[model samples]
Each structure stands twice: as C-alpha cells, then as structure tokens.
Target: MDPRKQRSRDRLYAAALELAAEHPIADLTVTQLAGAAGVHRSTFYEHADSPQALVEAALTAELDVLREELLKDRADAATAVAKVTEAVLRHILIHVDLYRRELADGAGGLHAMLSRHFRGTTETLLERGRIDLDVTVEGMPPARVADAAARFLADGTVGIIDGWLRHPSARVEDFLRVYAALLPSWWPHSPAA
Candidate 1:
C-alpha cells in the first residue's frame, strides 16, 4: 500500500471511530466523514463507499489480526482462545458507545457483519480441526453438524454481545463470565473451566 493511501485510510478510520462514537454511522453522511477525516470526498470514495463501510473495514481489520494470531499460536490452544476472546470483548468495550449506537436495533449492519465474520472464522477453525465439538446430533453428517454448530456459536455469541451492549450497566467481566459459561464443554480456553 502506498504511504499516502495508508495515511488517508488511517485518518478516515480515526475520524470514523470518533464520529461514530457520537452518532450512528447510518445517520452520518459521507461529506461529514470526509470533512472529519480531512480528506477530499474523492479520497474517501477511493477507500469506502459509505461511512458504515469504512467503520466496518477498520473494526474488522483488528479482528482479522486476532484471528491470524489465534491460528499461529500452537503452544496453548485454550489460553490462546481465551486471550483472543478477551481481546475481542475489550475491543468492543473500548468503543462501547459506538457499538451501543450501531447495535441499538439488534439487527443493524454491524451486528450482521459481526455475525458473518464470526461464523466464517468458526467454520475455518472447525474445518481445520482446530476446535473439537463434544456433542453430535443424531443422523447428521459431520459437515452438516459443523455448519450448524458454527452458525449457532457465531449467532449466539453476537446476539449475547449485542444484548450486553444495549444494557448500560453491563460489565465486561460479567459478560465474559456468561459467555464462558455458555460455551460448549469441549470448547477450549473456556474461562469457566
């Protein structure tokens, strides 16, 4: 990536996070983002089509890094999983206001994107046999079971996070405890274990 382009993207991402913390990205205009980012509208267009797109790209980039690290860390699967999950939760907590606004409706774009990203990540881990499932449904093929499990974990986790964000008094530690308790017994790195 060109240094100039990278700088522009960084500016855009910073501006998006700042602005999104105050207002829902859906209600923000591209012009507002361009002005906040100190980039021309054309420059903004070069990166993302909408403010929501830019915010999603910026947020998911962090998650992608965590996912890559999780795949590379082989010394302790359980610890690695716990660390990554905590990192993810902390990341959201850091931007709690932004997430609260974005996910206020429960079925917002951010929620859907997160669900898709998590579902894909879980599917990858399962396909690689990085995670084990201790329970099996009757008469279901392994692949079918894996898909169902992935969707369940992804959607359930996202839904829980969304609910937590919607509640103003919910603490991160409390959410983590609940999340860990809800994980399947075979899941590695469960804080509850």
Candidate 2:
C-alpha cells in the first residue's frame, strides 16, 4: 500500500460514492467513476474490479469508523453493547441518504455488508470478553453460547434498526431505551441459570 496508491484508491472510493448518491449503482460506469476520482480508468482497475466492489469498500470504510468508535470506550458488557448500538444507529442516521439507496436496492449488497460487519464486530466484542453472557444453555459451551447470542443479536438488532431507518418515526433516544431494556439486567428473570 503505497501512500500515493492509497490516496488514489480513496479518491476512487469517494468518486464512486458521490456518483452512487446521484445515480443508481446499476447505471454508474467505470469511466464516470474514474473521471470523478480524477484518476484514469486503469487506476480504478488497480483498486476495484467492479462498481459493486467499490460500493462495498466505501460502505466498509464507513462501518469501520463506527467499529473503531465503539472500541474506544472501556465498559461492562451491558454498557459496551449499549454504546455499540447507539454508535451504529447514529452513524446510520448521519449517512441516511447513502444508506437509503443502498438498503433499498443495490441487489442486497448493502444488507450483506452490514450483516457481515455487524456480526464480526459482535464476535470481536465477545472474543475480548467485553460482553459477558452469564446464562448457559444446555449442551452449549460458553463460547458457543456467546457466538450464537452475538449472531442472534446482530441479526435482530440490524433488522430492527433497518426497519426504523425505513419508517424513522421514533427518536434515537427512545429506540435506545428500548434496546437497552433488552439487556440481561433489564430482563424480569435472571438471564443466567
């Protein structure tokens, strides 16, 4: 990763995102992306093979920021989860326009990237022991339990947030309150058995 090459790649990604915001990904062309990026078409080829790859790279760049932000604060499992959820929603709201198009169409590219990123982040949290899963399910090891919990949470939370993004009626704080209540401590019965 040479510095100049990295800058060119960044420019290509930025150009693709800008074009994507104005036109559908299906309609965008490599020449247009390269032109906007101020790079030659050959340069773009060095970075990404296709427009979809550019879209995924751009989206991953954005999501990576959210992940880094979540990793900043040290807290208990419940608190960390809450912070991660809040950060995720805030990031989405900030880029609602880009996400609206991606989430709406784009051949499920956005959904796939989001699911993978969110789930991987959740798995990282579990691996770091930042989020403790006290409850043990029968026949499942603690680590396996954590993995399953992370998967479920990642899927359910993303689904819920995606729905909210589509409708966007509730305040962020209101949604967060509901999300926090899903934590083990907020549950009526002890989560651990």
lDDT of 1 by residue, 11-117 (tens): 99999888888988888889999999999999999999988899998888878888888788774667777878887888888888988888878878888878887
Superposed by TM-score, candidate 1 places the C-alpha of residue 121 at a distance from the truth, in angstroms, of 2.2
Model 1 CA lDDT for position 149: 84
Q: Per-residue error at 147 for model 2, in Å?
A: 2.6
Give the number of the best model, judged by lDDT. 1
TM-score, every prediction: 0.90, 0.80
lDDT per residue as tens, model 2, 34-93: 999999989999988888889778878887987887677665545555566677777677
* Residue 30, candidate 1: C-alpha displacement in angstroms: 0.9
**Backbone clashes in model 1, listed as residue pairs:** none
Number of clashing residue pairs, candidate 1: 0
Q: Quote the lDDT for 189 in model 2.
A: 21
